[model samples]
Target: MDYRDVDIVNHQRGWDGYFKLDVYELRHKQFNGRQSPVIRREVLERGHAVAVLPYDPVRDEVVLIEQFRPATLSVHKNTPDMPAWLIEIVAGIVEPGETLPDVARRETMEESGCSIIGDLELITPRYYASPGCTSETVQIFYGRVDSKNAGGLHGLAEEGEDIRVFTKSSDDCFAMLRDGIFCNAPIIMAMQWLMLHRDRLRREAASTAI
Candidate 1:
């Protein structure tokens, strides 16, 4: 249960952007009585992010975001001309001195125009979206909101995020899952959790309101 096998001899940053580059000197002791060289690798210093899945009980719906994801097509697409449009929960990189819930609420407002936050639920925390190269940890949350008049594209002009928000019925969202309309991993997981807990959530909402 110990990760003491790798020790840093020297380290430094190598990149300048949203993420940081980290270099580490490692020493590995072989089980067969051998010691390897002082190997060095440029590691990625992961950044923290947050996402939210907003649900509306009265409307029986959830809000999702659709945007053009350039990276997906660059890495996974068979055709270069194809656009990698993604349907995902609202998310944003955590700003300095900001709490996770605060980031979630801010992102919700920016992406969906849902100014008020209701009951919040932690879905899960996860490692880098792609651990092999990027260093990013995402904290995900779910909550109920009033999606009665939610729609249209909204995002910060400075960040170049042209996001379109969609409010769909629970039944319709689940049907999209069955039909493979949702291909993003995090959104898929969130939807699956909703599927598993929908009944209990409805019961709780009913009892609490009464």
Candidate 2:
């Protein structure tokens, strides 16, 4: 008698590229104890990913990265004011055998040239990038780091990732969040989470100095 139950009539595979598309013909149970009409949905399967915000408590700064996104470029190509290059926190696809923290740290190092100093803090629970058309879920984390020497070019050539890493004060990051400079959801969410817990993190760091 579960109203959430869904019956799949047929599942078909579509384009097999970096992202695989899955088409499903399905029917769901209605609240009135009846089955609804068949619904066909196409889902993009790009696998799950991890996003990390590298924060240096001692410096009151956070490491951010910039990169060119083709998809984003297409969206802004007609708009002269918008740039194709986007600023974002460190993130990468979660490998099959790797844990969330593992990928977070690895991606942080690969993209930012900074080593995580303290333990990785879970920013929040995992979230869906796009539930309507994709099965991609993202887990975001807060990795404590020393950002004194965190800048430079990074990213794997094979992956076509040319990332530029930079560190900005927490205040500046917050301002960017407020100004809607970031187009992605994870960074904005992470920044909001940091705003709530930043004093605790800095206080912990300050206490450790004593």
Candidate 3:
């Protein structure tokens, strides 16, 4: 409920660099209102991020990106055949002076070459990617786009990003979802949200056309 509920005995910075790691020693109130033994935990302090699913309601299509993630290599070492390149929606870390929508639009262009056509529809509230070990929160959005020319390789070379973009019909995307082709959390959540609201979004896009 409050800081009083968790008694902070000690804390120290475990690592300081591009990202931070913090180690905390604390005791919290138990189910029976008793104080539990002090426990030490290390949390990764990744900053917040924003993700946008670019959709073309008129064409019934969505733009996605494929990129390699070194983090997945460790998890797939035994499988060897499992691809480390993941399919995901456009996303970026929130810069110091940028708003969530700004990040969404900027990332959409950088990752997919798709310009957002209208205001982003907030799909989900802030959610932690890995609450157990990280303090990173992500906000998700659904934004209209013109996907006719969305497919291509795009990314800033200086940033070491080699992203391949794909513009797929909603049905195709849904099939990928059913087959577990998407491994990213934001992409899965965005696709599920689109599946539920696709019809309504199409109707709105139709009205705006006239």
Candidate 4:
């Protein structure tokens, strides 16, 4: 059934903070073509976000970043294998009036001190971070960049972000991916696409230079 088939009985704010929570009591058309009983669901109102993978074609490298995330604190503390600081590509939530591409480039600079040089190759139109609870969607891209000088600590002080930026050759990145070092979705998607198109991209870049 389409979204119109679902009825939203009541929607009210449950929490107001950096992230919002909306309480929903609704019913939808079931598979049997019948109305279902009302169910309560609390959805996180995170809005949209953007993530960009910075790839240096000439150098055949990528800019990566690491930052602490409190969401995984419990797992990181209890599970020895879990890391509190996650290895992630540049990502940030979309602010009011900013486009998806705008946020991608902005976050790239803020998190990694790298600016997107050329056109951004849209990797995924919508990467639903977690569809079960959050309404947050991410538009992912891979943009050309110069990683020669793209290393340092970044992120806004007011936001309490202490991002560590570094670069890794495309080969090393692939090896790390194979070792299952990355657990985030955006990195996985971007790395997989690079794995499938590295040769073609290199050829195109070489031709453009010559």
* CA RMSD of each candidate after superposition: 2.7, 1.8, 1.3, 1.2
Model 3 bad stretches (over 4 Å): 78-81
Q: Model 2, residue 86: what's the lDDT?
A: 89
Question: Which pairs clash in model 1?
Answer: 46-135
What does candidate 2's lDDT look like per residue over 81-199, in tens digits?
67688899999998889998899989999999989986888887888999999999999999999999889899999999899999899999999989989878898999999999999
Count of residue pairs whose backbone atoms collide, per candidate: 1, 0, 0, 0
Return the TM-score for each candidate structure: 0.85, 0.93, 0.95, 0.96
Question: Against the true structure, candidate 2 has what lDDT?
Answer: 0.91
Error of 2 at 53 (Å): 0.7
Q: Write the per-residue lDDT of candidate 3 for residues 1-210, one digit (tens) a residue.
A: 566799889999999997899999999998898899999999999999999999999999999899998888888978776789988999999999999999999999999998998789999999999999999999999989998887879999998999999889999999999998887899999999999999999999999896
- Compute the lDDT of residue 109 as modeled in candidate 2: 92
Model 1 lDDT at residue 129:
78
Question: For residues 1-210, could you state the per-residue lDDT of candidate 1 as single tens digits?
Answer: 146765667877778676688877877776775666898777677677888888876668898889998778665656554448888888888879998888888889999988645658888866567676666788778877889889998999999989999888889999999988898777888899899888877776777674
What's the candidate order when arranged by decreasing lDDT?
Answer: 3, 4, 2, 1
* Better-scoring candidate (TM-score), 3 or 4: 4
Worst 10 residues of 2 by lDDT: 72-81
Q: What global local distance difference test value does model 4 have? A: 0.91
TM-score of 1: 0.85
- What lDDT does model 3 reach? 0.93
